[model samples]
Target: MISVKNLYHSYNKDGKYQVKDVSFEVANGEVFGFLGPSGAGKSTALNILTGLLPLQQGEVVVGGYDLKKVSNERFNKIGMSFEQSNVYSKLTAKENLDFYRKLFDVPTLDSHALLKLVGLEGKEHVKAGEFSKGMKHRLTFARSMINNPEMWFLDEPTTGLDPSIAADIKDIIKEKNKEGVTVFLTTHNMFIADELCDRVAFIVDGEIKLIDSPKNLKLQYGDKLVEVEYMEKGEVIKTTLSTVLPEDKRELQKIIEHHDIQTMHTKEATLEEIFIKVTGRGLV
Candidate 1:
């Protein structure tokens, strides 16, 4: 649904780029993640794709229209939710969505349904200025869907939200994706990426380090080890045994036969571990 090639963006006349030599593609119904830390240029790339920032160099295309000469009509097919909430403070939650609904030429989702979907059903009449940060964030998220967009650009959609609310947001994203919305998610949260993304790109210092499915990346970089917690001399002993070694397998067999096993599970590399391995830096 989206394609970018040799994308580069510089913030100043000196030509120091924030996004350099970036390239990737998002399939028609795929949820693609751009993973990185703060100032790693995830947002810079996203801003350029969404037309928030001017195209500095290279090519970008969304929904088959060249970004360089894309029309306003093309924008109607896209929706965006930034990390920071942008809502009309004086307007009520319903009013906020109702206002955005008029901006699109396409049909819009119901404002009441959107507010309820984001867990703000009763706050429809409350002025946005009185809302907490998380409340406003939810409102902004709902507004993004006002156009029933085909492609969704989300930057840290669940950041700063409590666990329950974050889960709700994630469920909503999943539901939208199931309905064929293509997602371009930019986030430092590995768990969100791992759960929602079909494939992820590890980006650092404005360049992409790697791109693959989370399952494939883990299989490539994860260790073949089994973690065991067992009773040894009245104490709970926790250890890992390599699954690829014969000696380790014998040791595990002996433990299961002679020792009381408390817990056992395979240990695999997490997305963050793989990211660190690829980029030489943590997501944070």
Candidate 2:
């Protein structure tokens, strides 16, 4: 659904670039995550794709139209939600979405349904300025779907929301993806990327370090170990045993047979750990 090759962007006219030599593709119905820390050029790349920033160099195509000469019809197939909420403060939640609905030439989703979908049913009549930060964020999310877009560009969609609300947002993204919306998600949150993305690209200092499915990445970089918490005497003991070693496996077998096991699970590398290992820096 989207393709970018050798993408580059610079804030100033200087030779240094914010986004450099970036390239990736998003399948028709895939959730492709662009993962990075602050100032790692995730936003710079996203802005270029969404047309917020002009294309400074390289090639980018969305829905088969080259960004260098893409027409307005192409944008109608795209939707975007930023980390910061961008809504008309004086307008009501319903009004905010209704206003955006008119911007598209294609058929749009119902404002009321979108508002309710994002947990803003009652707030339909409430002014956006009166709503809390979370409320405004939810409103922005609903507004993005106003066009019923095929390509969804989300920037930190659930960044500051509480767990419950974030879960709702994730569910909605999943639902949309099931309905064939191609999502380009930019985030620093490992959990979100691991949960929602079919594949992720790790970007650091404007260059991509790696791109792979979370499961594949974990298997490639994960430690061959199992973590166990079991009752020993009057207290609980927690330990890690190497899965690759015969001695540790035997000891783990003994624990399973004799001790009351409280919990036992494989100790695999998390996405954050893998990112750190690859880039020599944390997501931050």
Candidate 3:
């Protein structure tokens, strides 16, 4: 559904590139994440792909249209939710959606239903200026769906949301993907990427370092060991056994038979840890 090849962009004629020779693809009905910290050029790449930024070099194709030659009608198939709220502060939640529905030339959307879906059902009549940051974020999220777009571009979708609300948004994203909407998510939040993305690209300093499924990346970077916690002499002790160890099976059996096991788990690298290890920089 989306493709980028050797993409590069710079804000100034001689300035350093904001996005440098980055390339990746997102299949139909797939959720692809661009994971990076602020100033990592993830947003720059997204903007270029969405036709917000003029292409400087390379190819970017979305919905079968080249980024360099995309028409205004291309927006009909795309929806975007930015990190900052872009709705009018004076408009009510329902009004905000209503405005976007008309702006997008989408007459089939139910503005009230969209608001309700985002957890602002009763607050539909309240002006957005009075809403909390989380409320504004939810409203913007709902606005993005006003067009019932074929593809979604979400930047920090759950930025200001509480746990419950964030979970709700994530669930909605999953449902959309299941319904065949391709998702391009950009965020520094590894947990969100791990939960929603089918595959993720690690971007730093305007370049993509790696692209792979989270599960695959975990397996590639994680240890092949099992950690066992046991209680002995009123004290808790833990030991790790490499799965490849010559006596691993016998040792595990002995520990199970002689010790009171408290807990056991396999050691695996988290997406955040893997990113740190690969990029040599924190997500911030």
Candidate 4:
């Protein structure tokens, strides 16, 4: 749904750079994540793709229209949610929804249901200024869906959300994906990326080090051991057996077959681990 190649951006002609030769793609109906730290050019890259900032070099295309030459008609194909809340604090939640109620030409959306879906059902009567950070985030999320575009650009989507609230936001994103919305998400939170992104690109200093599915990266960098845990004689016992080691398969089979296993799980390198190993830096 979105494509970028050899993308580069800089703030000034005196050699201050924000994005450099960055490239990636987000396919239709897929959730593609961009993981990077602050000042790492994530927002710069996002601006270029979203037609906010002029492209310094290379090409960007979104929703079958070249972003560099996109028309207003193409906007219906894209939607965006920014990090900061832009809602009017004096406006009630329903009033906020009512504000953008007709921004699109499609059938008017049922904002009451939308607010309920985001967990602000009864709170719609309250003005946004009185909301906590988490509440504001949820309301902001509801605003993003006002257009029902084909693609979404979410930056730090779960910022200010508690675990439960974050999960609710994640579910809303997943629900949008199920409805065939392509997502180009920019976030530093690897946990959220691991759970929601079909594939992620690790970017630093405006350059992309690697892009791949989390599961595949884990397989590529992790040992093939299944860690087992159990309790015996009031003490915890643990053991590791090669899940992919043919020679140890028999032993693993015997252990599972003969002993009381409390829990067993395969070991795999996390996206954060793989990113640090490749870039020698953390997102923070």
Best by lDDT: 1
**What is every candidate's alpha-carbon RMSD to the true fold?**
1.0, 1.1, 1.4, 2.2
* TM-score for each candidate, following the candidate numbering: 0.98, 0.97, 0.96, 0.91
Alpha-carbon lDDT of model 4: 0.85
Residue 36 of model 2 has an lDDT of 92
Q: Which 10-residue span in candidate 2 carries the lowest summed lDDT?
A: 63-72
Number of colliding residue pairs in model 2: 0
Per-residue lDDT of model 4, residues 147-266, tens digit only: 887888898899777899989889989999999999989999999999999999999998998999988888887667888887667677898888777867887787678778899998
Q: Candidate order by TM-score, highest to lowest?
A: 1, 2, 3, 4
TM-score, structure 2 vs. true: 0.97
Better by lDDT, candidate 4 or 2: 2
Candidate 1 has its poorest 10 consecutive residues by lDDT at: 10-19
Q: Rank candidates, lDDT, best first.
A: 1, 2, 3, 4
- Where does candidate 4 stray beyond 4 Å? 230-235, 244-259
- Which residue ranges in model 2 land beyond 4 Å of their true spot? none
Error of 4 at 22 (Å): 1.1
lDDT of each: 0.94, 0.93, 0.91, 0.85
Misplaced by over 4 Å in model 1 are: none
* Whole-model alpha-carbon lDDT for candidate 3: 0.91
Write one digit per residue (lDDT tens) for candidate 1, span 215-282.
Answer: 99999999989999999999999999999899999999999999999999999999999999888998
